[model samples]
Target: MTNHLEGVYQIHHIFSNINYRFQQLINSSSLRLKIIYCANISNEILRFNKEQIYSLSLNESFSINLIDSLFIYLESLRITSINSNELLLFISNFQSLPCLKSLTIKLLQCDINHSQIYYEIFSLKMLKYFKLSIDDYSTSLQSSSFNPNKQMSHLEYFIIDYQCFLPSITNILSYMPSIHYVSLMKLFYYRSSLETNYPSIWPNLTHLSICLTTWDTMFECFEVLISKIGSKLKFFSFKNYHRNIDYFNASRWENLILKFMPQLDKFYLKYTENVDRILRDRDNNEETNDFTRSFWIERKWILEIEINNQNILFSILPYKKQWFNEENLFKLNQLVISRININKYNYFIQDDINRVLNFTQIYHLEITNENLFIGLLLQITNCLFELRSLKIHSLLLEDDSRDLNLKEISILYSIHLTSQIKKIYLRNLTNIKQIDFLMKFSPYLSFFKIDYLHNLDIPSILRQINHTYLNSLCFYVPTAD
Candidate 1:
């Protein structure tokens, strides 16, 4: 019995079994004071055995009658799941737990007919964190009776997993005066319709995350939020498909950030499409040159080329020859070349190669699953002089692949271009020779990561390189066929 109880800090059971165990544990001192309980136990059972438990997680069927007994020992409670009916039943029960700190309620599947009672529950004086995860879309329209004007002095962290709604934001601002962190996930589109002034409501919030679709919508939503609370925001993250936009339009937000939130410290932007346009247009202004003008107009030409076969040949003609003198052509070509988007299997013209060689200020370069012909590789070797981080992703490996030769090029270029690189991440690198080459070139590199390299002798390579300055190394080998 002692051995059986040694590691058993938690017990989970159905209602009937919980009753029997509740009685048994109450009688036996050894089993009464367990740390956690997750079960469909009734309020009577929890009340009867209240003194022995420290943590409790009830199923949807948990009743409100248990609150009186549970609150007496609720300080250790960290997680809870309640349904609409249970919430309605337990509206008054919330005030019983003066020490309750964390609460998670499942309001997604529950009917909102009793949402008026929600406000009554928000009066909990000791609650610090609240997570409301709504599973159903229609439930968002239901207004909670929770009044915003009532002060929830202790509440600090609030998470709403649904669309952003005006009422929800207002209610939170009116209630939780101390909220510092807020996260909204799986937000629906309609919630953006809320017209409430933004910066005014969220003056105290410091950290925020919104998961939505499209960069345009995200920018608009952020504009609204910032117009009100931008001065107070310090950290921001946009996750999933919430803010999808073309690179050119997305870069406009830089001005928006500079204008509204001068104190902003951290920003993360990610998308699955081409980012070259966004990087190129980030500094666009009215005093642009012919080069910038031609670069800007070429996007229209590329789109036309995609739609019409006749323009493909003309579009394929070198833009440098058409734009400038032979002497200045190389320089203009390099500037325009960096602005061009790379699609599948396009041969690198001499201008493209020259552009890469001249663009020495590029600090981060990502070549992912794109075919880089030898000419392009040479240009990359020449231009990537100031690169601090390099990522080579999804390069295919054949028995006679050219990637095996990249290590030598990498070493030679790193020595000539600049020895500023401290991190290199290689994903799906199938060549061992390439690995050996990079090891020789970057002896002072601090971090090296290689994932999904086939048939590579990892241990032997580690022994050969024995990189003195390398602080982190990761290798993933494929299983035998």
Candidate 2:
């Protein structure tokens, strides 16, 4: 029967009949199996059961006798959600599984005071990858937690979510020789209370993300630490959200970036418009009216402005369209114009159009308006021919504007104007007739996103478009409405 079963590859009641059948298979000359068990089974099954199901179980502490017997045959095991008591029990019965290569234990909820997980986990000789996410307070209590001294000689990837009363850069740097990628999210603490000096180099760390929030003297303290470590830092993100902008000056930012980071590729700033304006104002003060003349001379790096202020337009322009020339200004790559009253200033239309055309390199463009006329639309489309990505927000079609129809508009302007455009975003296209006409021309478009269109036949419009190259399509409508 066993030979016949092996020939045909059938085991009907193998686990249930482990005592009678398990040893036969283990001893069989023909049978070969790599067992994988996912269900929660206990020590009682291991001791009394006749059949064997590869001897791997999810439950950590079944029974002492069962564990002892099963340890000989156990190839691999995974235990999850083990409490402090259960963890201690598993550690006490720790006989090495020679074939075990993979292990995962989630200890975010485990009680640090009662659990011996920290001490016992490092003793695992074969662990290749390890992940630990702990609450900030539990990591700082000077109890005999997991020491970083364990020679994880083979360990490749290590992730830790640490939240302690205090964060130590020295402690992290000590273990930096082995770690490749480090993600530090919301590691919040008061900087004034920290007693130790910061470290200079994190040798093997290729990637890092840190969020710091401080008050009063904390800014100065962080600045000193950053200056010391900034040379070795490759990728950096610094954000400070304070009510008083005066406290955090722009000079501090310039000193850090200009002095320290030579190989930095990407930098993100999320603060008020005043931050840039303040810097500009300071520059203008030093150079007087020759601000543009002295701008590039002092700062050798190319500065890209990500601005959302209409006031910036007014400030930069001496008198709308009359003062500023498109040829003189720096090239803008991305322009986001959102919900501003530009109808009062028709001169701005001609100036903005000229600016867009002159740049010829803008990759991303966003225009938001509730009352843009057909003439203005035509002018915009004419200039936006070089755009690679376009987004139109809250576009309202006037009843009595220019007579340029949608089909004519597409053929004459949009299709030819933006031949390189890959992504198009449209919002609040209340008019169905206009959208139906837009669907015909965009062929190279890979992404199309639409939101809040009441009258349009969405499904039919989607079917009409030849989206052979389309990678992403998104439609959003209010469920309640």
Candidate 3:
């Protein structure tokens, strides 16, 4: 097997328990390996060609002493879940790997001073891309003087996957004037009166993504930072969890884009706020048209406003893609159905539903209607091109007096073969016939979760819906007995 796989350039080991011998591989000169190291291998320093391996990823915390035995001339290296001492040792070994251009470290150590880590990372003169994820909430940069000879990093890309304060990011950016791309997965704002404002040093920076997890009062500081560095951005994405009424000012955003961010080709904004608090402002009734201006229309950035579970979300994004997933199912379920319920009396009108819902953009859908009929479900599948996940609270048909006709059966069978739906959740299901009806149209379904199974033939349903993709089947058992 080793001889057969000697030509393999990329090797990814995802297993956690497999104790594969590293000595079996005699030729790993061109191998780009990703492995999860176990404690048993910590005592054995496995040797290999350190010069030819271009990339390596250690997915677990291994002995820091093993760093000396690993490849030194690696162009890219990723280490996950390392401690403070392990991080310090790795930093000491960075001096040996001058060819290392991309370095990623995910540190699990908490409640420790990360200032030294920050300093040593920036000292990597040849590094072009650097990403750090620290689990510690207090991962702030302490004041540390850089080496006089090595003042700045040549890094062109920087990313922080942890919640870091904006001031600390700005301080780090002061040493990375060559950076062109920056992504802050979670940015926080901790008020500090002594924090000094820095000028925009990254003249070549073009792409920026920031997810602000700060208090509402942090908007002012956030705006200041954007104004300084947002001028040259080609792509800008900003998401805020903290609600501020100022974020609703579309005119302000338009002005900022028109004046400062003229080079921006794409702009994405997701602002969420409490539904009751925002709707209380009656003056904002006409604010919906604020985003429909020529500026937004020219960019093809569609504006979608949704009210879900007590929160209202305002999103502005390009119309080229659908951003639906399991995490967004709760919101999409309400948004999609609300569009159909616009005319309360015409809820069952197929023509109105077809006109209201754009089937192409609707991927994941949920039907909470207690009075849903088989005809209405068939009408929905007629227009849907890429339906992925379907969750129905109750498919209790209003009229089960008749079975599907020849034409209806053909449509259901065609959808069963072509439909992209892989997940189905049935709630308040009381009959096996309803399960049989769903299984006919969802032949590709992989995940099925039923809310209840009182007196229903569960084994029969499972046998009837048996398929290779059916890996997950869940039922809610109310009692132990």
Best by lDDT: 3
User: Stretches of candidate 2 above 4 Å error?
Assistant: 1-110, 113-118, 124-129, 135-156, 165-169, 199-201, 213-217, 228-230, 238-251, 261-389, 392-424, 427-432, 435-481
Give the per-residue lDDT of model 1 (tens digit) for 94-197. Answer: 67776677776666455664335446546777778777676666655454444436445566887777654544555555656677787777544343444653
Clash pairs, candidate 2, are 17-50, 17-51, 18-50, 18-51, 18-52, 19-50, 19-51, 136-163, 385-417
lDDT winner between candidates 1 and 2: 1
User: Compared with the true structure, what per-residue lDDT tens digits does model 2 show for residues 371-440?
Assistant: 4554454455555565556667655445453355554456545464446666778776666544544454
List lDDT for all candidates, in order. Answer: 0.50, 0.47, 0.66
**Number of clashing pairs per prediction, in order:** 16, 9, 0
Better of 2 and 3 by lDDT: 3
Best by TM-score: 3
| Deviation of model 1 at 441, angstroms | 8.4
lDDT of 3 by residue, 171-191 (tens): 778778898999998877655
Error of 3 at 185 (Å): 2.6
lDDT ranking, high to low: 3, 1, 2
Which stretches in model 1 have alpha-carbon errors above 4 Å?
A: 1-36, 40-49, 52-54, 59-66, 76-82, 113-117, 143-154, 186-203, 212-222, 239-252, 268-481
TM-score of each: 0.54, 0.45, 0.61
lDDT of model 3 at residue 203? 95
